[model samples]
Target: MYQLTFFLEEFLAQYWQKKPTIIKGGFKHFVDPISPDELAGLAMEEEVDSRYIAKKDDQWEVQHGPLTFDNTPEDNWSFIVQAANHWHEGAAQLVTPFRQLPGWLFDDLMISYSTPSGGVGPHIDQYDVFIVQGSGKRHWRVGEKRDDYEEEFRHSALRQIKGFEPIIDEVLETGDILYIPPGFPHDGYSVETSMSFSVGFRSPKKQELLSTFADFVISNDIGDVHYHNPLLSTRSCNGAISEQDYHDLETMMRSLLDNPHLLKQWMGEHLSQNRHELDIVPSDPEWSNEETYQCLMNGDSFNRISGLRAFYHDAQPEIIFINGGQYTLPDECADTAKQFCNEQVVTAKSLGNAIHHPAVLTLLTQLINLGYWYLVE
Candidate 1:
């Protein structure tokens, strides 16, 4: 088991969201969690989401590869493989160290390789990412993510930066990690054959925010938010809209968006909950004291995913929340679970030792059977 160092805890507590950080050689016994071959295999599967982008001479180019790279040429190119960790358990372990951060805060794991002079060009991302340098060296130039749009060689759909000034410009080596916050512009190209692991977190898009807020509004069934203003008679010089009415419309829209309750739901769904939870469906539902007893007799362990997101309510730190549901545990169990929630993995024995309670054991059993909990035999 990897022990949480004082520095890791301190960094997360202080600069995680407030600022950026770069931790050199943070992982030891270090291995490339998954290789390019494995990523290619997963890409071949139709159900998976994968994409690749390349940087060539004075141009940023992209090619969609679902296993074959026939479209790609041989020189001065970078190859990006995305979400490798999502499909492969081995790759997922590399992410285990960052479990202290909430799962919702994570967007995806992207792996990339840049041959000499290959890079993504200078660009900014509107998200937070930890760029873990795996093998070889890469020179990085980063700047603050700006709102201005810069037209370049990019997908027509994407809004990207034109250019920016560097705030942190340096070369990254094996095991080194560079942290970039949202709105910060950064670019990296290879000094050699370099590999990088990017763990990202993103704010929900407008569509996502609006749709979720609408649901929140609906959930508040008793609220009097119905739009009801008597229509005025047509009395206009140009039959055009008046500034006051326009302002009123804008105000109403803002009011709906500004509602505290609505904001909370948006946060809960996209940030507080796990992205993987939507894909999960508990297997066995029927449980009894007898069944629980049998599991104990057989020494059967609970099933838990190493990536499961567990946390306590920010305000009510007493209430434990996981997979979009809330449950309260005994004081000891709550504290213990909180520790496990923020950790990569924990055993049933460890859990039992932490919180000696039948109910807690039962919950673990349910989670295990549901495949949300994992137990080592």
Candidate 2:
């Protein structure tokens, strides 16, 4: 199990999104949950998002996967697979220590296996990442924050920046962690053959918000109110939109913002949605309400699929949004709903009256059958 050497509150207030900080031996005596061979096996799978990057004498190349290492040389290359937690139960355990943060803000776990002198080159990521060294050693150099750096792309899959000066340069051993915030140029190369696990957080861009909101508006049948002006005054310039017109337009736009209920629903649905594909398979035989309730009473537990996004809003207290779907709870089952949203593991004991609530039972049964939530065997 990974252990934190420093306090989370202090780390969040001091360094999160503001600067880079390295915690030596963050997971003291850390034993990697997944091995390099396991990671390489995942890279060959069709559904997994994997990449292979190689650098040879200043020339860099990148290849997208599902890939195999049969034809490629072993040295001077790195193999990366994204959302390992979603597919492997062992990889999912790595996420246990970081649950103190908001559940919805989590993106996924990305693991990389690198050979000697292997790296992806200097690049800037727009999301926060906690890069944990799993095995062997890696030398990391993190540069200062700069948005205007020119990018050089040798291949369509790779975009790299030139000449990054280090703000933090160190060799990280097994269990060491390096935290880098958004827009900070950073690069990591294997001092030896190494494995690194990255726990990343979501930072949605403005364009993404606008695009997803447009979809939400169309789907929900909201924001359809046409602008109507009851008071029309004579204007000197017909082409000009006067201050009143601007104000009216702004108010019309703000209608989406002003509707708290609608905004909450949209956010709940949007935030819970996953950007990557999930390795979910519906149960061949669906669980019935009676079967689910009986299992709950029999002391059977439930585990949420790792990397599953779940959230609730204060404005929509009874609704638990998860995996792009909304599950409404009874007033009596609100506490239970919070547990389901906040926890990766769920027990029958913590459910209280939710187990007996007919609507909640039905919803749980459906989710279990759909494989979003599974019965612990």
Candidate 3:
């Protein structure tokens, strides 16, 4: 694992949601997390979120895929296929070890698979992303964030610039990372058969908040607290419950949100868990320590858990909601706790600790069985 302290000396102070910063080979001996073929196979699955945009005769056409390349377009087009890591186990593993960057730094790890002549066109992204060059070469045209930025062509899920502008335009070799902050208009084209890992961080917009709030209400046992017009007792025939009724409804909703107990807990659960579920296919549960094993171990080598965190509050808590589920730990189990909150790793010690709570064990077994975690010998 790449140590944070080592990078701290040169760490970009304003990295989290700030301007773009590219650190070449930031993770030493960094290899492409997943292969192009693996990513391509993932794009075929329907349950996983995936999208593709390719230029068609100077026009951009976007499509959902389990797609195969047609003619290996020679020019004037590129394709971006997103959320590859979410759908495929092999790909998701690439992202799992990088949990040091908190899930919030990742909207999802989208693998852009393109043909030599392919490109997604110039576009502005509202989210931050690290474009890691994988196999082959890609020519990138990126401009620093500008107030004049506006997308010229917009298809569903695809945004393109009206004209090309480049503050930094160049070719990226395999293993190079190009960081782009939100609001920057950029484009990428494959110089040869190419792929890019777009590690995106898409924060919830205000509308998403209202949406999740409704989901929060539905998921949790929020007893139906309707608008109760206490004023009906007054028998005011003068109007249909007055603007005061609206006020009362607002107050009721506000109170529910303001509920110190439930709101706080719900937010914790929601933020801890991801909106999308990780396809945690498990491997058979085996703890027989081999060389990759220790007779007894502390969290290390993907086991000694460190650097678990929550992003919204920049908050760290003992427990977290992950992979659409809640996993709890005592405040003392900080490392394991951080592991659960920050990643999908299921540690043996953590499992052993929850032995009394058989339910936790059962869930852990399923996760292990699903290949989500194993002793990282």
* Candidate 1: worst-modelled 10 consecutive residues by lDDT: 274-283
How many steric overlaps are in each model, in order?
9, 0, 18
- Give the per-residue lDDT of model 3 (tens digit) for 1-377: 32211343244465645665555654455566666666666666665556666666656677666566676455544445565655655555556534555465456777777777687667777887777777788888877777876556457666566865587778888767787878877877888888777767777688876787788887776857665655475644866756777887778878777886666566666565555545544454443233222322454333212212243222445545544455555555445455444445554464455433444444444444444444464
Q: Which ten residues in a row have the lowest lDDT in candidate 3?
A: 303-312
> Considering TM-score, where higher is better, how would the candidates rank from best to worst?
2, 3, 1
Candidate 3 segments whose C-alpha is farther than 4 A from its true place: 1-12, 27-30, 74-79, 87-90, 96-98, 146-148, 154-157, 218-223, 228-250, 272-277, 280-319, 327-339, 342-344, 347-363, 366-377
The candidate that achieves the highest lDDT relative to the unseen native structure:
2
Report the number of the highest-TM-score candidate. Answer: 2
> Model 2, residue 241: what's the lDDT?
87
Q: All candidates' TM-scores? A: 0.71, 0.95, 0.72
- Compared with the true structure, model 2 gives a TM-score of 0.95
Of the candidates numbered 2 and 3, which has the greater TM-score value?
Answer: 2
Give the per-residue lDDT of model 2 (tens digit) for 138-241: 99999999878889877677777875889999999999999999999998999999999999997788898888888898888887788899899888799998
C-alpha RMSD by candidate, in order: 5.5, 1.6, 5.6
Q: After superposition, how far is residue 55 of candidate 1 from its true place, in Å?
A: 4.4
The C-alpha lDDT values of all candidates are: 0.65, 0.86, 0.60
lDDT of candidate model 1 versus the reference: 0.65
